[model samples]
Target: MEKEYTIRELTKLCHETAQEKGFWDEKRNIGEALMLIVTELAEAMEAHRIQDQANFKEELADTFIRLFDLCGGLEIDIQEEIDKKAQRNKQRPYKHGKIC
Candidate 1:
């Protein structure tokens, strides 16, 4: 049977690979990781704008990878936080103060 990987497991793998590559060195900071996440978001946006399905998918993956790496580095329980946020959102009003 194939093993199903959890978010935490994937994040740990990404963090380990980053460390091996020297990208997650002692000099690296959360701010830098966050900016890289933002950069990936921008790439995703551009891909969407250009209607490039492949690039869009790749960029989206990159964004998630960066996010996971950041969470791992910070030792954050992202799954718990996501669950809490989702539960809190359930109590929010429809559209939640949005104009749309």
Candidate 2:
């Protein structure tokens, strides 16, 4: 049987692949990539909503792939970073914090 990755594993895969491509935060165009995805989501939600299951999955996968690229471009190990940040947030007590 083929192996399946959990969400965290997939994220790690993206991070590792990013390293192969030499992603550096200094050279990333984060705003552009973010804008593109945001635009796609907005248009997709506003227009068809894509009721077709296969099509929806494809769109979702494309979105995540772009996000992975963005993470690579920013030189961020998203899974580790998110985990670290979550731990830091847990250590700090904020009544109205939105860091995560």
Candidate 3:
């Protein structure tokens, strides 16, 4: 069986790959990375609009990879933050402030 990688490990790999590809060179700003993340989300939205399941899945993965790359670059613990947010969300009322 293949080894399962933790979120942190995957993120580190993304960061390394970005560096190797010159995507994180001195000329590029963090805002560019953020923009790429948003672009991936837009692609996902377009895929969903057309009901393209394969593209939707691929775009979602792209979004996550961009996010993970950013988080890895910033030295953020995304999994830890996710855990904290999940615990906090559990204390909220049903449906919270949303109408639906």
Query: Candidates' TM-scores?
Result: 0.85, 0.54, 0.85
lDDT score for residue 70 of model 1? 79
Query: lDDT values of the candidates?
Result: 0.87, 0.67, 0.89
Top lDDT hit: 3
Q: Per-residue CA lDDT of candidate 3, range 40-97, in tens?
A: 9999999999999999999999998888888988889988898999999999988987
Models, CA RMSD each: 1.9, 5.8, 1.8
TM-score for model 3? 0.85
- How far in Å is the alpha carbon of 40 misplaced in model 1? 0.5
- Global local distance difference test of model 3: 0.89
Clashes of each: 0, 0, 0
lDDT of 3 at 4: 95
Q: Which ten residues in a row have the lowest lDDT in candidate 2?
A: 42-51
Q: Candidate 3 at residue 84, lDDT?
A: 94
lDDT of 1 by residue, 1-100 (tens): 9988888797898777777888866767778889999999999999999999999999999998888877887889787888899999999988996888
Which whole-number lDDT from 0 to 100 does residue 23 have in model 2? 62
Sorted on lDDT, best first, the list reads 3, 1, 2
Worst 10 residues of 3 by lDDT: 22-31
